[model samples]
Target chain A: MRKLIVVLTLCVISSLALVAQGTPLPDSTSDSTAQLLQQAHALYERLDLERAVPLLERVLSPGWSFGMTKAQRVDAYAYLGASLALVGSADSAARYFRAALERDPFTDLDPRRFTPGQVAVFRTARRQTFAVGARQVSALRFDPRTEQLSFTVVTTHGATLRVEVRSVDATPGQVLFQGESDGLREIAWNGLMADGRLAPPGRYEVRVDGRSRLLSRSDSTRVYFDVRHELPALEDTLHELLLSELRPERYPPSAATGDLVKGLGIAAGAFVISGALADGDLGSRSSALPATVAATAALSGVVAFVWRRHHAEAPENVLANARRRQERRLTNDAIQRRNNARIAQTILVIAPASGVGP
Target chain B: MRPAFAHASGPLVLLALAAGAPTAAGQWTVQGTGVLSVMRHRVDAGYGVEPSSGVLAGPEVAASLRDRLTVRLWTRSGSFHADGPGAIDRDVAEAGLQVDVAALRWLTVQAGTTRRTYLTVLARQPWTTVALGAEAHLPFTETGVTGIVRGAILPGVSVNGLGHPDLAIAVASGMEYRRGRASAAVLYSLERYRFAPSATATVERREQLAGLVVSVGWSLKR
Candidate 1:
């Protein structure tokens, strides 16, 4: 009996799900709000206000059976407001128009597409709603020397507004526009940092903050972008020379003794060879011959020992090392100059990026 | 000088010119040196010994490339006066060409040829020889003082009126000092020749020459 009861409950739930799929539900997204707005626009063009009004109102309603982008939602509110205005519901039209204006202060009704009454209603909505917003950054690359990066910002009504371009690090950035601004205003930036240098490559934000002069309300909005530098590849400087690369500047202590020993050894060799190799029948060896070389060698030994002892430093090696260091410095300086010139030719590459904050 | 010496000297002059030719790489050095030597000459012919002495003086030119290879040509002429009453007086003239190749920092391998002529009232005699040798350098210091020892063996010897010597040897010990481009050296040199008894020459003959050689050099290129 329990199994039969559970089977009947499952059959009822399956039938309800099929019915829900066949008939659109308020909480189920069966169509995009953009598509619904398009349908309403077609209906309103045919003068079917009763059918278009319901469709556009459903798109703007909370928990409505559709999803939408910010632009699509704004389009739905605009169409609903225009339809109601033509039907003589002036208060309802004004309310829907203000909702679109609060979302995007640059929102407007085109006179070619809408009646004069609807355009007037949009203007009125703009005056009542207080909002500030920045347009998406366009992808562009321009040399900072001549061209500029442009940004579009708006205030719903005349207000004291400030627009700033800064890095994502929240560093003090350059203010492109300030003072009273109403509606849409184009701001230009020369791609320079606050310190009058070319803007370094990084993520940057374009922020617009305004306080309405008529109302005591304020609004702020920001858009993010990535800045890249389009420049020639820079060369790297050579590294410092190691100790092994340079010649020794001082002679070792053993050098003096070694010199002395070498001289003495030569003197002894001359005497030994003269005594051992000379023929006895040659009427005795000439003492003067061997004595001259021995004396010179022995004297050289003494002189070398004294000279090496007094002059411990090797001047030749020191001079060579200094010249090497100077050469390295000159090469590095040339590299730095080339790198600076390449940096001067930098072109800022700007592209829109997803923002992190309002 | 005998024509034989001029022929032996030809290849040495050519080699020196080749080594000294101007090149974009390596260092070249040409040094001209004045040589002064006092020589003692002795001859033994089984029965008696004849000793004589004389002074030999001449000029030598040396050309080196990169301090690694050197070529030298030298000539010295002098008269030897006999000490004994019956011995004959003779004039001696010698010329040599030599090449030295540095095989290591302190050692050099050498090959050379020498020609000697004895001019007497009775006859003119010529001798030609080829030798292989090595020299060892012992540097005293960075100031350019060096000690040198050299030894050579004559493998080919020819004499106008005598048989080949059973043994022929030459050796030298010296000291050299160089400052800037000027250099000076003093060396003790000895040469000996021994001939065994033969059918044509019944008596064993021996000859020896010993000398003190001093040189002053100036470098054309360093």
Candidate 2:
């Protein structure tokens, strides 16, 4: 007799499920929401509450539609309420159940299917979504070592969300994290900036923004994070900065080349002039005066040619050359030695290789 | 009297201008040096008796544009009596330009030309010579004292084809003390002048002079 009764109950449950499925869901149902509801139901049957509860809550709270048929609406509310009750949100479950009845008084709640506490709590429901509650967000905790930032957002319904880290003045902002809550009660961020870098240590405000059909809201939390490095690293950074400053800003390789060529030409000019001058002084030894004078004239012509040659340098280039000279003077060996001595205290050096062991 | 002032003044003015020029330009270099040398000379063949001894002293001032080119003006005079009636004497004033290339860490090669006015009792005969020279330096321990070797040979013509047509070879070995751009050296040198036969002097003549030279230098670059 018991077996027969159990079989009858099974048949009734199967028909109820079929009837729900065959009811021609609302034409306005978004394919996405339909898929989510189907997945939630499957997970609930498999007892994957960790995954199913959020999906059911998402389908009910924000995914719920006024355009849905009475059957569809009842399905969302009943499933969401059952999921919430299973997760121990008895009061919230009852609230959703009452919200359904407010829309359609003929809503059915099976006592045999739901816990006694859920039934008792359901009796206290007053209105639809309006009574679900105000939107609230709180930062759970931040762990600097793990770089994990955790937070919770409770919304009366599903919301599109955006998260950011910004200066106290709300300027210098960057997006930190964002997503549809998908009924997720908690969020954890690995404390990475958009570029996946651990943000430099400073005071910054974390902002969470939510927008739903009925309302839009934002909440902020302040965090000050510090990243510490060894003294050697700081020293190395300073050394590099100083080295960079000491480096010549402009390398005018061609500038010196032309000057060097000019110098060579000048030396050659001096050489020939010296030669002609000597010849003129010794002209008394022979009557080769005309020949010597011609040679002298030729040398003079060369000198004139060299002297007439123009050297063009821009005004800025001249200044830059002077600046480079000054920088070069700064590297006098003695001064460099002294500066190196002063900095050597902080330079970490590995021991040199020793001779073979005895 | 010889225009001792003229001979002295030209180099003096060059040095003054070189010194003043660098000071004005703010980056040129000037180096002044004074050398005192004791010399002994030998006549290579039948021309004279034994040997002669003399003193040579000079001052050199060089102006440089950076590290590449240098213009140096110098003057030196030496007088000595032979065993017989005559004296072998020379008083010279010259200006030179050198292009130096550092060939190694402790060595340098230089090429240059010199205009030399050789003073005689009759007149001053000027000569031009081009030379290739090499210099090597060695540190004596870490005490900042350096040993130096310098050698040069003039193989080119006497300019205008009228002056001493001789191959002049000079070599000096020295020890120097240097600090910054200033240095002091005590040197010994052997200098040889081999003259080709000319219309005025028929016989080929070779004169070799060995000398001890002491010099001190100071630079304006620093």
Winning candidate number (DockQ): 1
Worst ten-residue run, lDDT, model 1 chain B? B1-10
Off by over 4 Å in 2: A1-75, A78-152, A155-358, B3-28, B41-46, B49-53, B64-71, B78-84, B88-92, B122-124, B157-167, B198-200
**Tens digits of per-residue lDDT for model 2, A1-358:** 9999999998677556645765322233454566667766766664667767776666666545534565566677767776777778878787777667545433545789666766655554422232111122232333434445554443334556666655343365666546664233455555445565544433444555655534444333233322222122211111212444443444344543443343333334323322332222211212132233233323433433343243232444446556765665654555666655553322211111111121
User: Is model 2 an incorrect, acceptable, medium or high docking prediction?
Assistant: incorrect
- Give the Å error, residue A20, model 1: 30
How accurate is chain B of model 2, given as a TM-score from 0 to 1?
Answer: 0.74
Residues B167-192, candidate 2, lDDT per residue (tens digit)?
57766655566687777876556556
Q: Give the TM-score of candidate 2.
A: 0.44
TM-score for chain A in each prediction: 0.81, 0.28
What Cα-based lDDT does every candidate model obtain? 0.82, 0.53
Tell me what fraction of the real C-alpha contacts between chains A and B each candidate also makes.
0.66, 0.00
